[model samples]
Target: MALGVVGASVCLLVFLAILSLDIMGFLSWKNQFPVDGKTVLLTGGSQGMGRGLGKLLAQKGANVIIVARDVKKLQAAVEYISAAAKSQTQRFHYIAADVTSEAENIRLLEEATTWNNGQTPEIVWANAGAAKPGLFLETPLETMRRQMDINYWAAVYLAHTTLKNWLYPSDASAHSTTIQAPRHFIITSSSVAWCNIAGYGTYGPAKAALRSISDSLRSELNLYNGARRSTATTTKPAPYDVKIHAVYPGSILSPGLELENQSKHPVTHELEASDPHQTEDEVAAAAIKGLERGDYMIATNWLGQLMRVSGMQGSPRDSLLWDTVGQCITSIAWLFIGPDMEGKVWNWGKKNGMPAAPKS
Candidate 1:
């Protein structure tokens, strides 16, 4: 009984210390970026998470530009967002363009800037993505390529185009005079990017690529902003405050999710059954909340949070103490839970007979 009391006291002391550190860290972090009156450009806004985010941003008084391939759906989404607008000045627009095409993404940005009175978007959401779930051998090469193009390359193109257009200009004179606002670029990855399951071979890798790119951009932007601020000649405007956020969302109930579920392996479903499945609105709310808090890494669910801490690779830390605790938990899970899960997956695959790889 005395030992138990000592252990409990130690645990309470540790918890209090962590809580104090988190509070101090939160206070010292960058100020929250406001969404009100900002122009936000969102891709894949025709439905699901994109549409939900659009509505929420609109309600927050942001001028929202939604881009997607489906004209009908885009139009509907715009109308819905317009109805949700909190202010008369909060305009909602739609662009019908394929984000998978670099040229089309350029065109989409051109139109968005033109509509926003030649100003670039203050917040950019690279939310367009697709998944083709199957065993590595069964899925077609073209299908995997398409997923990469849509999920990875499209985001790259948009981020590149946005940064080039907003940060750099053809004329050096104009670049010096540009008054920049705080900018945020958000990329949507999946929880499976870090926690690779058997059925998500293509999708997992693509999202993982996105997370890597986001991390790289975050580092580069930090350096760029620091250098520009340090070398200011009193002529150029202060360096742009650009932030990159990577989101790892678990199961969401949306049209895209439903389609993914239809083709997903039974084992994949069984393994993920315990994780909470959020609605589109729930995901959007969580994502926006994370953004408001200036979190470098956003996880929409507990499972995503676990995967994030477990597989974290040099990303910005939100809370050192909590993150360390999560990492410890992840290590234990890897030693026990991971192996058991892998064994189950192997057994299931062997019993069910996975499809053979396509011929080269």
Candidate 2:
């Protein structure tokens, strides 16, 4: 028994060492998602994680364009991003518009492309979303519709518009002999997308839908990517390869979280007490690091990672072999954790009546 335990421990250590090397980019010669000198258009960039990501990208030498409904906040965010820019040449701009409108998203892309000197942004991030936590029966249908509009449909609109431009660029004929950097479409999801909690009826489904979209796009885009590699293709493929990524962040300490807390039920709070709360900058940094390392689904914290592995389903893994290993371990842990969560919620309801219903 002692020898068996020792052998298992040694094997685990070796696997971890290899996984760390892959995640840290030591196994790759070049950064997978290099943003230097690339144009990035980020929605919800006026504040919170969006603003933090804008600043970080600017520091990494990306020309950033932030979109939000608040002109004052957008201006402030542009200033923040400009200050963090690596060089004076790095540009920062802002667009004040509501992303929930499909027409507005189409116009927004046109404006951004014109501002970027007729070049479409190589990196697009759909980061504008809000959460209102409430019980399913108690939540209003209007609130659910609004959540789905901003969280799911808005991303759908943006992704459609961006991918169209990227796949058929105006200047595709001018492509150089050298391959250009691949375009990236990143979506921001929540840890609750994978792990269900009682109070997120209006919010969780939308985030999960976003994750689902990411999964579909990840596979569907492969057809286009494969076409690029074939010499027998009759038509020209996209100018560059396309990559899709989704970032799953746990509870964040930001304006959005404060707003969610206002509507979050007491029971919901207690149930999620174990989730780690990270700052906007911390989450942004971790997400960017994952992008640099070419991760498909990025988790901002340990809890988020656990949730991600729990509901991985058919989504592609960043490191297949290592991720499978991690998933096996997480699956074993979830055997206990999953039932424990259900029990806690059940006991809470028995101990206390339904949480206070929202006043109509």
True-vs-predicted CA distance for residue 80, candidate 1, Å: 1.1
Q: Candidate 1: TM-score?
A: 0.87
Q: What's each prediction's TM-score?
A: 0.87, 0.90
Tens-place lDDT per residue, model 2, 119-230, is 8899999999999888888888999999999999999999999998887666744255578788999999888899778889899999999999999999999988888899
Indicate the worst ten consecutive residues by lDDT in candidate 1.
168-177
Model 1 misplaced regions, further than 4 Å: 1-25, 28-31, 169-180, 232-239, 353-360
Strongest candidate by TM-score: 2
